[model samples]
Target: MDEECSAFIDRDGDFMEVMCCDYGFRSGASRMYQQENDGRIPKNAFQLGWDNFKSELRSLRQSIRFDDYSTISEANPPRTPMSRAAYSVGQAALDSLDAVDRALEAAQVLEPLRPRAVTLDGVTRDSESGSKLINNCAEIRSKLKQLKLSNKAMWDREHAREQSGRGVETPWLIKGVYLSLCLLLDFLYENRPIQRFWFLETVARMPYFSYISMLHLYESLGWWRAGAELRKIHFAEEWNELHHLQIMESLGGDQLWFDRFAAQHAAILYYWILLGLYVFSPRLAYNFSELIEYHAVDTYGEFVDANEELLKSLPPPLVAAVYYRSQDLYMFDSFQTSQPMQNPRRPSCKTLYDVFKNICDDEMEHVKTMKACQDETVSQDIITRREDGPRVGL
Candidate 1:
């Protein structure tokens, strides 16, 4: 099945690579669950609910896999140990949660016009039991208030501390663009980090695509051929962004129609703008990406630090486990331009915290690559590429 998907992807152009590869990963992850035996689920009722949920996900994946819209890309499908394995698992989990959400929505639609309070078996409104209940409710509310205040204070203090040495000073125009995006995202996704990250990754992949497009154009015109390896590195970088986007999607970042519309349109605009910049000056293009990637590194770092406790409580997504734990680290090392040639990255992904940490580290690698691209003497040897075979042909 994997080979079939890979072949299908390879037949398509580079433009379809990101989309098709993601679909293949999601489908492959779903297949993993489908292969598990019924004995894996405990006899408890709650365990049965989970088993049924997994079955539903399998069905959804099977349905989606054959759809024309889902099969529209042709690049080498990412291998089993690819980056952002969390996304593949998260997508299945997200669909399961969505099923629950839809059922709740339907229940709400069918609910009675007026709600009624029900008395407990041995309690009445005027009884001592009722008084105790009211008191308990009051106490619960007070604790919730205190908790919220404590959380708010912690976030504010940590955020300020994290901001102390984070930003990268860029050209005035680049700074303007960065500030505008930050403000716009703040306005649109206030207090919603997952959504913000989703939008960021969505737009983030565009610049790499722009870079590849320009490089391909230059090669086609017989103008420049030295960037053959650079294009592969950029694709790997874009591949990293693709997983980040999927992770955000699995977390319900694109749940709102307006958010989807905003991200898609923004991505389109960003691609075109970056393409123009690359056409005029590759340094400017790389500098802009460097700024954006640097900001991503800081944002993810702050998010992981501030939400360390909460993030740690969540299990690492399956795809994440596969990516970080699997033996193949070829694609994983392909984007890290800063790493010494002999010492490759081997980041962990034991928990959600580790996943975010790895993501931040990935962005820093992208920052390094972008900075390297700005240098006139960046050698192909410095840009990592797979030894097995060529990723693209010009």
Candidate 2:
């Protein structure tokens, strides 16, 4: 992808415009803005509630006017009229609530009560680009269905591979939890590849967040400062995963309220579980993360191999291009412990295929880092990097 094509790269634009465009319509932009701008003004409870109410009312009206509940038929072919009506009402209500939540989230950065000068040029451009990518992916998915190359087929292949495991023995509890999560994903996201990936990315970042939280707590308590470098690497990994999540969101992976609810809740639960595990035994925590990272690699690898032609035909999302081809790649290189700093990955982001390929490669890097943490060699790697001095990639 041309660097200039990315809305985020070499673009002289307002912060709000860039936020709305690069992060799409979702809350990713709002969350990112809050992270970058720590001193952002906060909306009062009453004003925030009012904005949410207005947004929800608008969303409800749109849903009533436009939504036809087509997915109800696709999911349950023999639905009765009463059932369909119930589903429609329930779905519309849930969608409105989700819209309100997203609106309130955006208000965190946009200041709904304030008259901010916001430009929609980049937002419109990225929206069109994202729609094209989604449509291309849909056509490709239909083609895959015709060829019997379905998500279930991929899941079964991964299942068989899991049965014939190579290594990495974990406690029975960890193994059970991991297997349960995989099974849940297989069941919940049978034909929805993008949503499946969205949920996966949502949960995938939790381990790193948990690790970083624990490390931070340790430092604050003056209990352990040895993990200072490890905290940086974990934060870098989390940042990388956040971009992956945004890319999936740009592809409309988070349109459904139910999917959002499930993924976010699962992510929160996993984060705490991982935090507890880290408190007890950091090795075990790393082991669990290693398992999840390996699973992500397998899943993304299967996705890229199965949809290579279609993905290549589609353009990369603006978020993917910005992330993979950004001028500053210090965060990118930090998480990749297995690769030498001098020989860091400079991956292409010209197509959707390249994006997924890079994500798979990133997961592999996470796997290596997690294994290093488990084996207690990550500290040495950090020390080696320090000795070599910071690279000029940034």
Candidate 3:
């Protein structure tokens, strides 16, 4: 998922760089995948439309379809090919469905949790502060709803039954890409737990929501996947209501998949940090910080280059998705260096602050990995030049 929220928000530039790279690369991969399939398209959006397969289930021409894509606007502002395709698919699939409009699983508003603790670690806050956080959470969900709706429409418009466009022109590609982008944007909106467009009905219900959505989207687009899952889509407060792996891991559930087990498992850092908050009593702020640092440096660095080219070429819908991921990575890398493993107390416990550190650490590793991959490309170019030079000219 994300390394840390604040750091990610701050390193927007680094994040943007990574995102742009990821979208471009993924676009290439997706295009390759399409070519391999002889240009038809798939049901899900992986490497191209990885998360939800519906995006790729069209003609190859869909990639260039966003003619008037500028009309869309929501929190994230659709920016990748995947988003556009997804947007189109969402429209086709969602609209094609027989489900009632109110009953649709596409998006739903969640009731905000009134955190007894200012942070999840069991601390109290003044009424006004708590209310503010709750309101902010609501806002995040609302924005996400709009994003999802936009994508659904995008996909629908491009693939409209009446269109006779057989050529793979920009207009056609934009229509598909715009639709896919809309859906990708919607997925982000639904997947985010506390952010805009939080879908109440989604298994992205609690802490794992953000991670799972990210992982699924990454995999769907063939970018990368990581994180945890539960046995079934539905859940009850008491763990007994469902069937799960005997051990609390993802072994026996409804078969939740992960693209890269190691990278996605990186979420262990977040869980551990949360445990430190939820399960333990309040402690020194630095203690929490140290814990967060440990995870960031430890597991987060696992995926920086986990899926290089795939990550780089995300579609129009998912372009921003890659960007935010990179931006967060960049932000966390810097954030950890300064106040890492410190106390985040007004609440207490280094755990809270450290959680962010863990995330930052994860994103930074990605930054490192991406750079290494780029460097490798440069190095290869140099070697190629030397090889091409007059055969042992000396």
- RMSD, every candidate, angstroms: 17.4, 8.1, 23.1
Scored by TM-score, the top model is: 2
lDDT of 1 by residue, 263-336 (tens): 88899999999999888888998998888887777678777776777666554444555555556566676676
Q: Which segments of candidate 3 are over 4 A away from where they belong?
A: 1-127, 150-394
- For all predicted structures, in order, the TM-scores are 0.59, 0.72, 0.20
Candidate 2 Cα errors over 4 Å, as ranges: 1-69, 72-152, 155-165, 392-394
User: Compared to the true structure, candidate 3 yields what TM-score?
Assistant: 0.20
Q: Rate the local accuracy (lDDT) of all candidates.
A: 0.61, 0.71, 0.28
In the range 147-235, model 2's lDDT, one tens digit per residue, is 11255666665677778974467999998988898889876766567778889999999999899899999999999988777888898
Better of 1 and 3 by lDDT: 1
* lDDT tens readout by residue for model 3, 11-72: 33432211111111123333221234456645544444454343222211122122112222
**lDDT of model 1 at position 352:** 66
Q: For candidate 3, what is the lDDT?
A: 0.28
Residue 179, candidate 1: Cα error in Å is 0.8
